[model samples]
Target: MFKLLLLCLALLPAFAGAQEDSDWIEYRDAYRQMIWFEKYGKPKQFLQNHFRIRPRDKSVPTDGLRLTLNGKATHVALPLDALGRAVFPFSKAAYDDNAELAVNRKAGQLKSGAWVSIVTRPDGVYAAADLRTACDQLLAYLRYSGEAAGKSCAGVQFSYPKNDVSQVQFHAAGGAVTMLAPKEGPAFSGDAVTTFRVFVYRFAALPETGQVVTSSTPLAIAALLE
Candidate 1:
């Protein structure tokens, strides 16, 4: 019995390590799924440009972009190019803000243009200016191309992980029911669609080395209007 107890104690570390690895793998897969959903789920025409910030790039800090729409301030960490311009193809959260009016108001008064600023925190590292231009471009794409119309609904769909995880929790800007289905198939089925809003969430894991790794593609949902 004593020998058996010692053997079990010796195996504890291995078991714990395996568990940790399993968790990290699950998290990474979820993250990848979230990104995939955000990217491929959209109509190809709607995604004319791609705007994203890589999680690993030190140059693109998480709090690089600040948007003051309506009267509230929203901080966004978005990807940038070598020219310091934000890439196109933003997520819904990037533009869906109550303070859009305030952002336009504070940026500048222009007939066909607006001003936006990107300033880093703590050290106050300024990255770019006239971010509103990029936003305007995105707005134009959404408006003229009808991309925005595709994302104005209410519902939630689950994107299952590759592993045998029992449950996965997703984050959303609004409160909605979590359904056990892929949102894309039903939303695009051409059944008297009423609403069109989509949300995306990623599962990630931070290793002890401080490296963030994604496991799965991002998951996205298009809520039916009703």
Candidate 2:
């Protein structure tokens, strides 16, 4: 009996190391999956908003899932029917700012095991407009503080309305034009039009700050039919 006990104690370190290695492998694979989605998953980006987990041990049910965005407080309670799946709330605010998603494991109330998978959807839009024109108008607005010519805008692609469109600006920096769309804005009115407002910051060369400011003109829905 003494020899048997000695053997078991000697094997404990190996067992612990194996478990740690398994966890590391799982986390590494998950990180790689996220990176792939961010880079090659163009036209459709994924956000790590929702997470689901299927435990290796089936006797345990998920107790809950907690989400942390930039160290913010965000938590979601698991449903009674949540057996192999857990749903979390996606924050548009974090997604727009390109925030990272972090997941925390919960101790199951009913059993002694837990495992989970994370899932998220991409919220991007490809506008039916001329890309060049859109960029031109965007740049012009930033440079001269003027309105963009409607006909010039085309094939404009943007992330979802995580923010208002009116206050966004286009600017040139590091030899490339960049667009800055803020998360929220007060409403603004134009010529006979009540336009929704959003703040846009463009980086461009100006006489003063070497940067230009511009606003996005509202896209007319009626023009789509014509």
Candidate 3:
């Protein structure tokens, strides 16, 4: 029994090494899958085809998922059906309107309103840390001016188009804010490539929340940009 115990202890290092190798392989596979999604336009196309929820059907279901944002105090419940279909409160019109509001607010057009900025980092900025620094500065400015709600934000990550998959991480904590990986592919700058897009949330509540009681389809999806 003592000799068998010693043998098991001696093999522990080899077992640990094998586990590390397995973990690395799985990580690499995730990257590969991300690349495949980009190549075929999976998530984007899939949403367009399958999960296209109409405005008429955008009612607040009783058994929906409840979520909070801009601090845990602000309660928000979203409509998520058993079919795994999550109807996001986003539309082209809404995005255009909020984007205009954001621009006007930045240019001193609006006196008192909320708006979020689409912060883009170009390839000229080599280091990811430096790019994030720029975003952080912009975020600080928005927060100090009282133009933004909570700090729901996301950073962009660019990867080689054909060789490997994109590496994007999505993290959402309690009510502070949520961060998402950037959409993969080539974003053309005027002369260079855009590395990533950092979307900063800075908006008041949606326009139609007063009339609605429960968590209905989102009227304004500006927050979902994160």
The prediction achieving the highest lDDT against the true structure is 2
**Candidate 1, 78-166: lDDT as tens digits:** 34432122433233443443212111111111111111111212221111121122223333333433344433222222222223233
Reference-based lDDT, each prediction: 0.24, 0.26, 0.24
1 or 2, which is superior by TM-score?
2
Of the pair 1 and 2, which is ahead by lDDT?
Answer: 2
The runs of at least 3 residues in candidate 2 whose Cα sits more than 4 Å from the true structure, single-residue gaps closed, are 1-26, 45-51, 64-226
What lDDT tens digits, residue by residue, belong to model 2 across residues 14-79? Answer: 111122212111222233333332343222211121232333343433345333334133333443
Q: Per-residue lDDT for 53-80 in model 3, tens only?
A: 1111223222322211111222233343
Superposition error at 137 for model 1 (Å)? 13
Q: Against the hidden reference, what TM-scores do the models get?
A: 0.18, 0.20, 0.20
Taking the candidates one at a time, how many backbone clashes does each contain?
A: 35, 14, 0
Model 1 scores worst on lDDT over the 10 consecutive residues at: 1-10
Q: CA lDDT of 102 in candidate 2?
A: 36
State residue 2's C-alpha deviation in candidate 3, in Å.
60
